[model samples]
Target: MKHLCRKVVAGIGIMAMCASMAACGGDTAADGVDDGSEMTVEVFDSLANYQGEQKGWFAKLVKDKFNITLNIVAPNVAGGGSTLFDTRSAAGNLGDIIIMGSGNGQAEDVVKAGLVADISEYIDDTEYLKQYQSAIDELTATANQESGVWGIPTSVSSLAPTESSEGVEPTFGPFVRWDYYKAIGYPEVGTLEDLLPVLKQMQDAAREAEGTDDIYALSLFKDWDGEAMQNGYQFPAFYGYAEGIGYVLSNAAGDDYQSLIDEDGQYVRALKFFNKAYQMGLVDPESTTQNYDTMYSKYKEGKVLFSFWPWLGQAAYNTTDHKEAGQGFMMLDIDDMTIASKGAQPNGTSTFIAIGANAKNKERLVKFVDWLYSPEGIQASGSQTNGAAGLQGLTWDVDEDGQPYLTDFGVKAVSGESVTVPDEYGGGDYTTGASQLNVSTVLNKDIDPNTGVAYNYQMWDSELAKRDTALDVDWQEHMGGARTTMEYLESNDKLAVIPGATYSAPDEDSKISAVRGQVKTSVVNACWQAVFTSSDAEFDQVWADAVANIESLGYDEVYQVDLANSKEMTAARQEVKEQYESQSQE
Candidate 1:
């Protein structure tokens, strides 16, 4: 690997150089290739938000820099299943660029099938990716590659592997409209069940005050579900449990494991909780059929009262106007719950980016992929997903003292406010003009070498200084001056930090994969049915029938495999925890 040419300069210099290069209107690509001829790269991105041609600012950025137009093929928007992937794989091409989950055996499967390219020969030409060589090697090894790099893992962190990934907030927990909760006098919620009555009162108050019929305490969507109902699976994590394997929930401590279908397990309990919400008219009736986008719209309208993730309701509703008005979602403590927090992933997250083996313009494609790992690429493309500040000189910029600050446009854009972008950057609202790939190459919490701070704008010194809005002040006071939700949880010992480790379950054999697929379909269908059941009897019957159906399909055999995998994961996690403890003691 010859690390000769640095395509990007350091820090804000990279942005300045790229902007100047684009302004020059030269016919040469960044890598010195002829740019007179343009190429449209087909991107099969499982995490993409838009399904067709890439547009807006991101399109312009790539076009100017690489002379490439991205044609995104998103399975998420095109039906949300393996159908697209299967069809594409059968046709002898997945796409020029492939982005998908690495944990489900898909990444390894593609490597074995020769669907993706080995980019080891080209890695030396990349500046940023060289720093992530360890991550690339780990992923390739996982794919059983002896001498070639098959993929680059997503969300690679610069932090030590022993540290927790969680920054200011845990990914999952209960977040509710602060104004309504305060209006109700902030009643004590001692348990999961106690949250129901409190939510009901809040919903009633919101409806009466706003004179709207659409208000609901809970709103859910089914688009993200896989082997089980994702919404149902979230509740268990709030109680220090997470999915270890298919149908298996493991506690954060990685000691106990339970089948999701067990009568008394957290999955069923979550279903019952939703059923109770439905009976109390606190759940949105449209929850069953709606997708995430639809549910997000409801959140933007203030129709939904509670969210299981901080990103969801906060991203959609926490605009400057709303926050200033003291009306936005904030973390509400559930005393009995120990929220699960994800630890830092030094080996990167489960998702990965790979190039097709038969991709057109192989060298150019590799160059483009390499750029995605660059600081410039991380800011430009990552702004849409991982909370990186948008393009320097546009959404954000460095001051004379070299401190990063969000511009006026960025201040509005980062907070989910609709702002018109300049025509030079692609004319449109900031949200729509954002990159549609919806995947991140680096973790937002990773420290930028240039800035000496996390890539996330929220952590920037400039952004932090402006956090004293009415909503912030009120929430801080209510939480006893806790600076952030994570601080509040940690102060009260209500958070369970899951250690980050590089362990993954071995890919299931053909027989096990078939059985697992059938089991997944049955479990998902049954879970949804139970949530919408009219009565306790109906819910019980649904669960019983699902168990019987899956068992007949060899559920027990699959469970044994999953159980073995869970045990391995538990051991791996314990090892990481022990290593961290030892380090701290030193």
Candidate 2:
């Protein structure tokens, strides 16, 4: 331990010398220092909040440990983090610490521009980070060799324990109101063709039963669009396509790639289905204009009869009253396709953390980063506590058998019974900082010392036990156990294509990135217009025009690049799989 500490100090010295900005002249001590002086680091990611505002228990822990405050800068819909990143790079105002989501091009661009610190030499020196050398190597393998490792992986958790909820139904898929389905006689849904008709009948039944005129068969929001509207995620999965942020790989085509706008494409077919639904008045008109929050509000009121993601429906459905009333969202085995979340294969790493080359307090920041990857740090960062996922005494407690259990406040917060805590108590909500920790590498293997069960999955059975018969328990029993649906899907060979696990190479990103953006906008607009068209003739016209417009806007170029990249990515994934298999055998 002493030797490792010395190495950590030596590594920090090298980083300080390499830093482009002037050092703080030892305003704070180096590696082993624990002075309580406050240091603020700016962070840019989806988890960003207004500058210097601490939001959750994790943030509070970070402050207490390193005495560092994080000022997170999140992206808006008009211009995502990439746009903000560009502006900041040009102005030299990039955040002190930067985090890039998987497949994002900002990290590559900034690293190439010499804006990120190279922490390569420090990894082996740090006690905690050294354990993840393989993960770091895999993530950085495609990058510039001269630049060294410029980022640390975030959000990479090992597969849950076999006894845990590892391969249960994914959080994404077709979801429906269980009570409404049962009320309407559980119409046959063995095929995609049966789904819409069943939904239409259910919608009518719901309106009649509730005496409400505003119920919708399905609700959608426009906020989550990436390369295509959020529906892009749903439709492609049904078609057995492995989709990344901007590209799609079809299982039928083998290694071939096709964006949604291609000829005879799954996306185009999905649009036609939506068009029929819209014509049948099964879709909410506000879907095109409303945000996620609005859609969530409607979901809570049981106004949405169908949804694409389980979480959207599960949130409101998890409540005591909703469960007892049999009104929450439940999974379905709709015939047309087996819906699945984008495969969560270990991509090595998906998110990256790097400090700005121009950052101050370099030594302190390095130490803080090292501490975050430590075993103790993983628990401090990831687990849920009382009302928040935090430390034991404050947010949780250990049992006589050394099992960590949620405090009453934690149960209330996590179960969505009541998430808000008084400001006078902790001054932050329970949901804050859920993403602040990168537990991807730790969750699978790290058993909370106090909890015999893996901390991540320990709460699963307990949480289910708390739900009434109509909610989680009902859903669990309906599926014949947590893993039953997944096992069935696997046995039937009905799983969707698993996307490649690594981020795309810079060459691929440069070639297709911009065109991919243009194609997305064109596709989204075209899809909506195609859906809203009144007659079959009008639909054909609208669809053709949309396709033509997208093609003109560079759809073909993006598709070609995606095709080439897909083959390479798939091969890389195979290699990683083989390596892991070999390791297991050994």
Best by TM-score: 1
**Tens-digit lDDT string for candidate 1 (276-315):** 8988899899998999999999999999999988899888
Pairs of residues clashing in candidate 1: 164-344, 165-343, 165-344
Which runs in model 1 stand beyond 4 Å of their true positions? Answer: 1-40, 51-53, 73-94, 103-105, 212-214, 286-294, 359-364, 416-420, 423-432, 502-504, 507-522, 525-553, 574-586
lDDT of 1: 0.79
lDDT values, one for every candidate? 0.79, 0.60
Per-residue lDDT for 1-586 in model 2, tens only?
1112122112121222222332222122332453558887887554333344556666666777778887766543223444555555554545677655434344444555555666665566677666666656655654444446677776444442111123344545677887788887766677665788889888999999999979998777787666676675566666566454255645522454666666477676677778788888998999889998998899888788887765577766446777776667777776667543333344345566677666666656767777766545655555342112445554566667655667777656555443655453345666664435323434433344445555553344454355446555555665546533455455555565453256454345554667777888887777777778887789998878877888897787877766666676666656655665676689
Global CA lDDT computed for model 2? 0.60
